[model samples]
Target: MMGSRGTSAVLSRAARMRQKLQSSLEASALDIEDVSYQHAGHAAVKDNANETHFNIKVISPKFEGQSLVKRHRMVYDLLTDELNSGLHAISIVAKTPTESGS
Candidate 1:
């Protein structure tokens, strides 16, 4: 799968990053899904499948005391390598269970 280039690859990358964050932050709930097809054939779509476009839904107690920006910053910091590697855009919905309507 190292050479694969498609939504699956993107999802895989996201899962890998989620695993990294889980280890680092001891998250309570983490769900990472790929939404590349929603933007497929759009102006932002890249010829290279590795190009980034993701919608992430994360629920974690780590964000309990942190502001939205701070929580996003933590995720961004953790995914710096992925960002540099190819990820261009991430649509993040971060919440605690209470805030998530759960």
Candidate 2:
């Protein structure tokens, strides 16, 4: 399925993030909102920057016993490549299924 791998290369950053988080976390629910436009004029943002900011909400069993900081760290760790690749900021709401009442 090398072609599928190639297809992923063309996905929007948000789509790639969604795929990564959903698969890695085994998330029951996942939402990824691109908020980059809100940072358009911020000093760190270049005129051509896209997918630099995001709001992410995820509910997963993997988070059940984890502390908030640990959950966030898990997410950050999963996205290290994205962070290194110009993804600047993320607002994350990491939750367990019970915590989210899902």
Strongest candidate by lDDT: 2
RMSD of each: 5.3, 1.4
Worst 10 residues of 2 by lDDT: 1-10
TM-score of each: 0.71, 0.94
Task: Mark the regions of model 2 whose C-alpha exceeds 4 Å error after superposition.
Answer: none
Q: Which regions of candidate 1 deviate over 4 angstroms? A: 1-11, 41-45
Candidate 1, residue 79: Cα displacement in angstroms equals 0.7
Model 2: per-residue Cα lDDT over 24-78, one tens digit each: 9999999999999888878887776989999999999999899999999999999
Supply the TM-score for candidate 2: 0.94
Least accurate 10 contiguous residues by lDDT in model 1 = 1-10
Q: Which residue pairs in model 1 clash with each other?
A: none
Expressed as tens digits, the lDDT of each residue in 1-96 for candidate 1 is 365345445566777778767877666677776766666676655684653677777787778889989989988888898887767778777788
